[model samples]
Target: NESVWTADQNEEMSNTSASPDSVSLADVSAEKATQGSDTDLEVEDPEKAFAGVMGAELYLEACRLTEVVPVSHFIQNLSKPYVNLNHHGLGPKGVKAIAIALVSNGTITHLELEDNCILAEGAIYIAEMLRENSSLQELNISNNHLDTAGAEAIASLLLDNMSYLHALQLSGGLYALKQSHCVCTFVSLQGNYQVKELDLSHNGFSEKGGQLLGQMLARNTTLEILDLSWNHLSRKGTVALGTGLRGNGALKILNLSWNGIGNEGALALGEALKVNNVLVHLDISNNQINNEGAKNLCRGLEVNGKLKILKMANNPLTVEGATALLASVRKNHNCMMEEINISNVLVNETFIKLLDLVCRMRPELDVIHGEVEGCITKIPKQHPNPMKVIQKYLKEHNLQLWDFFRNIDKDGNMKIPVAAFRRAMMQQQNIPLDRVQIGELVRQLDRHRTGIVDY
Candidate 1:
């Protein structure tokens, strides 16, 4: 399941100097970087500050610097684990110091530098390093304002590098779904043959980028997980991706949450699911799907028994939609689903009764009814106040408030909707809502509803 791949870095050295206004971290050395000497690896008494610098120095040596000191770059020395510097008061230098450590650290597999205020230059420096490094597996540099130029720099590296990374998380980067339409469609995943997990959630890469990536997935053979959550991929984008899935066989997990995909998109994906058997998990929460979309997906669920998890908690699913989905689940005996999250979806007595019956029939299935009472209340269904009922249940079950509320969609403007309600239900039920499912539902619920519901 885990493997390491490698390649040499290839790029022309531009005389291009980073902007003076840009925040500068220490620079890398122009030598084949090495780990601390065998002697330095062990120390009886190591000072905290000195340990940080030593870690920095070791980073430079390990990366094999090609430039001299003061090379118009970041960190000059390294010693500590790159990820441990996530403390308060870490400035650009501190950040750069950490990145330097990451670029060379052999033990670190995941580096999350999202929202660290890293600019194009910093990104370029790291991009150059990542092009050659093989140990790091997951890199998250999202929300750092990487424009097209910055994005392109990393893309260029990805276009050539034989990296060991199977997962790359760059959500909420400079690309905004609608805004990134004009950006050059140069981002490529063709070279990342071994990558299995990719999260481009909240980046502005709209349908165009989605299409590009979908096409890439069709040709690439190793990827099994792709998360395009929160990129506002509409029906057009969903259609484009569905076309790719028709032929792709390696993918097992696909997350397209919060993309405003309506019934049309759901239908397209459902059609693909009917024919494609490899995918095991699909998250389509917090989109524009309503009862009609749910019915389409339900049709697929009835016919496609391979999917073990189907998330449609959010979007516009109502009582009708929930019943539709439940009907499909009940009809499909081959559905190996062990969990279902239907939080905040206006789940009335109709849906709740059906779900309870399903649970009774299938003892192995776990069902979450986050705010089921509240959803029921919306349509004059028979139920007490959802919040009160939930509170009482938690009290009876000895569930903590945090655990109860962790699943509620904290992103909605109004009360319980499907997505928010679904996730909260999952948290309380102790079922794992796919990360992408939670991410999408979280964005659709009101903030006030977050972190309060319990078992």
Candidate 2:
């Protein structure tokens, strides 16, 4: 493969070096010749960076993608985790070249090809690459005109090689009912068994595709995060998703904001959450779910026990409705509440009491309320214990302890009681811990015998 690429680079060098401005790209070594500028990037081995870029350039040129990024930039950043080739007008031809390069390159894990206009033909090449590549984890192909054919092909790639792909971003128009149905069809028949995240935001979706997604969600246990925000999934579509959630035991984070899901849709989801023991993070922000919907949602949340994070920004939540929701969670002794976003909602005289409750229950809980800058004022922290410092560090990095908490608290409450700690950890994150060991750890955290720890 290197030999073939060298030959192509040699041909490209000879053909384009007619002017003094053109550098001998094939002969470039020791230093990358930027266009009258020196590269600011530092590398452990300059020689390795040179080789990486040369190989990428040769492979790209061989596939007739001449109008690509500068070789110097690619060399300096070849070993980085992500490659952003957005807005480069990488049409079908360029997309094919990139696909070929990606198959051989092992370092790049996240590839962004947004707005590249890589139509159906280009998508085929990408699918072929996905079949062969092993390092890629995320692919952003948004704003590419890869219609139904392209959609089916990418969907096939996800199903065939599920381990390599954890995230797929298909955000933009052209993701209507037809495209959604096409994607869901592949997922159901073939199976995207290992993908954890899927973002299809800003697509002009309707209920036909929503039903398809519901059908797929009913069985897929591997998917953990889903974003369908900024769409047109009104009550009809959201109801179907709710029905699917009723039986789903895997999904943890869901974003359905800006979808115009009115009170009816909110009611449906609230009812579903009553039986749902998995979902933890939910975003229904900017939906038309008014005071009635808020009350209904609280009714479900109070009885259900898994939710920890809820975002309701830009909803028309009146004083009565907002109070009802908060009161319901508090009265239920919900310690799992981590964050609540209620920006742009009407807050009445109960605002102070609401803030005080949140402050006492969760000193670390982030509350985004009202439109003022820094609406959530907090008191300065007291001196922390060494255990608290260690916990904070672990939480910051999402280390094993935090993962354990997340796994055990499947209902999204962010906090776990002392009694259920061991069982939940083993059942959720696959950590094998005995009752005694978990008891000791809980004792270390719960010094005052509060029976709770801020996870």
Q: Which candidate is the best by lDDT?
A: 2
**RMSD of candidate 2 to true structure, Å:** 12.6
RMSD of each: 12.3, 12.6
Clashing pairs in 2: 306-411, 308-412, 336-413
In the range 370-422, model 2's lDDT, one tens digit per residue, is: 63323447553344453454466666767866664675675788766654553
Quote each prediction's TM-score: 0.63, 0.68
Span of 10 residues, lowest total lDDT, candidate 2: 35-44
Q: Model 1 segments beyond 4 Å from truth?
A: 1-55, 58-104, 176-191, 348-353, 370-455
lDDT of model 2 at position 423: 38
